[model samples]
Target: MIVHLIDGTYEIFRQYYAPRPGHLDGDGREIGATRGVVQSVFTMLQDGATHLGVATDHVIESFRNNLWPTYKSSAGMDPLLLGQFGWLEDALRALGVAVWPMVDVEADDGLASAAAVAAADPRVEQVVICTPDKDLGQCVGGKVVQLDRRQDKLIDVDGVIEKFGVPAGSIPDWLALVGDTADGFPGLPGFGAKTAATLLARYGHLEDIPADAADWDVTVRGAAKLAATLVAQRENADLFKVIATVRTDAEVGTVDDWHWSGPTAAFPAWCERFGWPRLAQDAAALAAARS
Candidate 1:
């Protein structure tokens, strides 16, 4: 069985900004993104996805914000997008799919946890984390992989190496040196992607790198200055690594818990609310066919 873990927050952001028609509820709240996400899930179900779960950030601010003052938050996000977070969770639940609405932790942590759990089960043939977030590279290996649904790309262990120039295990270390602008942490200066990847690919991790450039085994331009910067910002690098690492202990349930059993009785009402009654019929048909 293939287990699919979705980054619901990413999907919401993607759909919200997409240049498509807008939808509004009776209360004048924009809900087009939420509607698009539900339709996308239905499309996945039609394409034979089983035992899938979606992880959503119930709130944009998480424990990471407490750690780093500059971490991404909902401060400047569109109110339309923010308003649909709860609706997305509810819609997924109504679709009979397992939904993990994280409050303290971010959605990435939930995907990591679900991937870990699914990969550990021998019954699962593969665990596909459906997101393009580079932070998730650390979770790609063995039965666990990543799927960028928008691009229709499947990323395995080799894909991680080819893209990042380092192995999957060293992703957090790589991010620490290269810095993730999207995550709001500035990595050490003079360490671009190529430099960070070259060093990480050679030494394997931040701590493994030699303190002195003279002791380096590989040849890299500006090794002396890079080494000095690392030394000066060792504490920041360590903190960034901690922030980049995805937590695998979020409370997502077992593989069996994510199985699709069919929609709930409230599904029809939700479909009507979304002004897409055909979804209700399609869901019922799919359920009947599966049964």
Candidate 2:
């Protein structure tokens, strides 16, 4: 069986900004994002996805915030979207999808952990992490792959190299050197994507690179200045690497636990409350057809 792992946070963010009309519940709360995500997953089920899990950031702040003060947080986020995080998790659970509502850790870590667990199972044919997030690149290899639903791209180990210019294992190191604006870390001065990829392609990791540019075998523009900056800010680079690395140790359960049986008995009431009458019928029909 193929295991599908979704980044629920990204899906919510994407759907919030989608061109579709906004939806409001009877209480006048904005629920467009949550509805959109649930509908999308329902469609995935219609397309024959039997085993799946969604990882959501129950609280936007995670352990990374302690490491770097400027790491991404709920600050300045649309309160409408923030308010729906809990609703989304509840709706998915009612729909009978395995939902990982992460508390202290972010959704990315949960996805990485689930991907590792799913990939390790001998019965699993493939593990697909459905997200465009670059941080998930480190988890791509072997039976595990990443699917960017927006771009309709499936990324394997070779695809990671083609896109990042280095192997999948070096993505964290490359992100450390080039810096991730989304994650709020400034890499070593004078480092850009190409520069980091080239250096990392040679050295394979941040610590493996020589402190002196003169000791480096690869030719880069302004190698001496870049090397000096890296040496001076080695601690920060290491910290950034730590931040970039997606932890696979989260307790996301085994592959068998993610199997989709069918929507719960409460799902119809959930759809009625959301005014999505058609969703309940479609879900029931799909469940019956599969059975």
Clashing pairs in 2: none
Per-residue lDDT tens digits for candidate 2, residues 1-291, read: 999999999999999999988898887778889889999999999898999999999999999999998998999998999999999999999899999989899899999999989888999999999999999999999899999999999999999999999999999999998889998888778999999999999999999999999999999999999999999999999999999999988889888889988898888877876789889888888888888
CA lDDT, every model vs. true structure = 0.93, 0.92
Candidate 1 lDDT, tens digit per residue, 218-283?
A: 889999999999999999999999999999999998999999979999888888888899999999
Question: Clashes per prediction?
Answer: 0, 0
Candidate 2 regions with alpha-carbon error over 4 angstroms: none
Q: Candidate 2: how many backbone clashes?
A: 0
lDDT: which candidate is best? 1
Residue 170's lDDT in candidate 2: 99
